[model samples]
Target: MFFRFACLLLSMLLFSGVSRAEDPVREAQAVIANQLSAFASDDAETAYSFASPNIRSIYRSETQFLDMVRKNYPPVYKLGNYAFGRSKLVGGGELVLQEVLISGEEGQDWTAVYEMRLMDDGSYKVNGVRMKRNTTSEGI
Candidate 1:
């Protein structure tokens, strides 16, 4: 029994090699992309499913959440094209930022900071998202 257990452990460790950097980042990006796809399809219920438990609690209803998104994050609702920029570990969680280029505009750039957290089920969800655009600083 002891020998079998040791062999299993060794195999597990050896096969669980995720040393490359892009693996985790690519997984995270895929999650965000899928969730965003749900949004673009006007599937509010599906989009809400991707949100964290805390966010779901606050929003209460998918309709309310969709309304809020349409009102505040129109770019996200009507996305032209988006590209994943960078992702990093932050505060025991992961932060992934993406730039969404709005369509039908001469020059518009919007960057969204997506805060993701690992859940108890070993799945990641979006804790929150903050969007900002490019603008010159007048005076700070």
Candidate 2:
């Protein structure tokens, strides 16, 4: 029941396109999807643009950032499938927690907790992501 409610709330946030103009869930999804799509298409520039300012600073260059993602987040770069799930608002909506179900190249199952941050442009960017491999009897 809780999962259903959370999914519904996230769905509302995702489709409403700036719900109340205060919630940034839609922007978060857009940025994440855009970056991932860029990765799939090998478009480093577009993917780097979706990252938060802090991430941009850390990576310092598009090539550097793209290499890091290709090396560290292979699943996100080459996913078999993915879907957004529950989301939680934090820091009065400045930050958000988004759950993602991801299947990797070899069909490895993972749950990604995406940390989203609202930017000055009235949009959201991906701040960080932590992935956990899901262990289940029924393999993905």
Candidate 3:
């Protein structure tokens, strides 16, 4: 009876760890959704808040980052009807890979693959995003 009890306790511990790991993915999804909503509303300050510190540092200022986004990823600024698909844990829960699809103005569609990293701050942030322009390409 003691052995069975010990086994059950161990199982519970393992399950708890798995549940903790899953939190990162959920946090990442929320962050991404918030950013998308801000973009749709043209609230650059709100959208910039969702970016990782590393990203913010790279851009130096929120205004600069907003300008870059507006100039380079204009379609993203007008994003709508976004959806996340095919999320997978990468590197033992240290990272997550997610496929994002968004519709733009005038029936335009965009697809991107995002790599999100779990930061030490207990928040998940997008580390990289690769926009897929061609659907016919099999390999990159």
Which candidate leads the pack in TM-score? 2
* lDDT digits (tens) for residues 1-140 of candidate 3: 99999999999999998787667667677878887788777787887877777788788777887787778776666676777766778676678777777676677777766777777866777676777652322322
| TM-scores for all predictions | 0.72, 0.79, 0.74
User: What does candidate 1's lDDT look like per residue over 1-140, in tens digits?
Assistant: 99999999998876665342325556566778888898889999888888889888899999998888889887777777777665676544444433333342455766776777767765677878877786322221
C-alpha local distance difference test of each model:
0.70, 0.81, 0.73
Clashes of each: 0, 0, 0
RMSD (Cα, Å) of model 3: 4.8
Of 2 and 3, the candidate ahead on TM-score is: 2
lDDT of 2 by residue, 1-140 (tens): 99999999999988776565565676677777887889999999998888899999899999999999889988888877888877788877799888778877777887778899887767788889987887322211
- Residue 3 of model 2: what lDDT? 100
Could you give me the TM-score of model 3 versus the true structure? Answer: 0.74
For candidate 2, give the lDDT: 0.81
Error of 1 at 2 (Å): 19
